[model samples]
Target: MTIIITGGAGFIGSNFIFYMMKKYPDYRIICLDKLTYAGNLSTLAPVMGKPNFRFVKMDICDREAVYGLFEEKNPDVVVNFAAESHVDRSILNPEIFLETNIIGTSVLMDACRKYGIGRYHQVSTDEVYGDLPL
Candidate 1:
């Protein structure tokens, strides 16, 4: 099986990539990361040379690039973890958050629909629940 993991260079996403790569040695894992402030490519160094693993640097909001990748890979599963996730930064500039988190997600889903994917999983942080007064 082939899986496309968006934001695979970020914290949570990187961990998932490691786990999946180890557990399923035969599965093809394509990592699509924009290399944002939150994303670190070094985190994925361990699996960089693995035959079943490949990395692609690009933003989820880029529809043409995303569509091209989907056509080339034709991944069976798409795990979306891409987002502008710094709470402090988001409070300062909410537009970027809206663009990456909302619009980017829509772009990914549209590509999935257009290119055909068996499954699409969205991974969101607990921050989505909003902060409660302490």
Candidate 2:
């Protein structure tokens, strides 16, 4: 199976890629990322040279680029971990968050529909729950 993992350079996303690659050696994994503050390519260095692993630098908010990728790769699954984090950043610039979190997600979903991708998953942040009592 070919899976597209958005924000694969981020912490959790990277870990998921590592786990999936190890678990499914034959699966092709494509990583789409904008290389934002939360994303660092070096974090994925371990799998960078793997034949089944591919990293594409692209923003999820760009519909055309996203659609083009879907057409080219024909992914079977898309896992979205792309979103603006940090509560303070959200408070300071909510527009950016909306553009990425909502608009970007829509673009991915739309591409999924257009390309006939059957599975799509979103990895949400813990910030929604905020601090919790022990």
Computed on alpha carbons, the lDDT of every model, listed in order, comes to 0.90, 0.92
Best by lDDT: 2
Lowest summed-lDDT stretch of 10 residues in model 2?
124-133
Q: Can you write out model 1's per-residue Cα lDDT over 1-134, one digit (the tens) per residue?
A: 99999999998999999999989989999999999898999999999999999999998889899999999999999999988877899889988887778888889899989987869998865343355778
lDDT of 1 at 60: 88
Over the stretch 1-134, how does candidate 2's per-residue lDDT look in tens digits?
A: 99999999999999999999999999999999999999999999999999999999999999999999999999999999988888799888888887888889889989999999999998755442245678
Candidate 1 pairs with clashing backbones: none
Residue 51, model 1, lDDT: 92
How does each model score on TM-score? 0.92, 0.92
Regions of model 2 farther than 4 Å from truth: 126-134
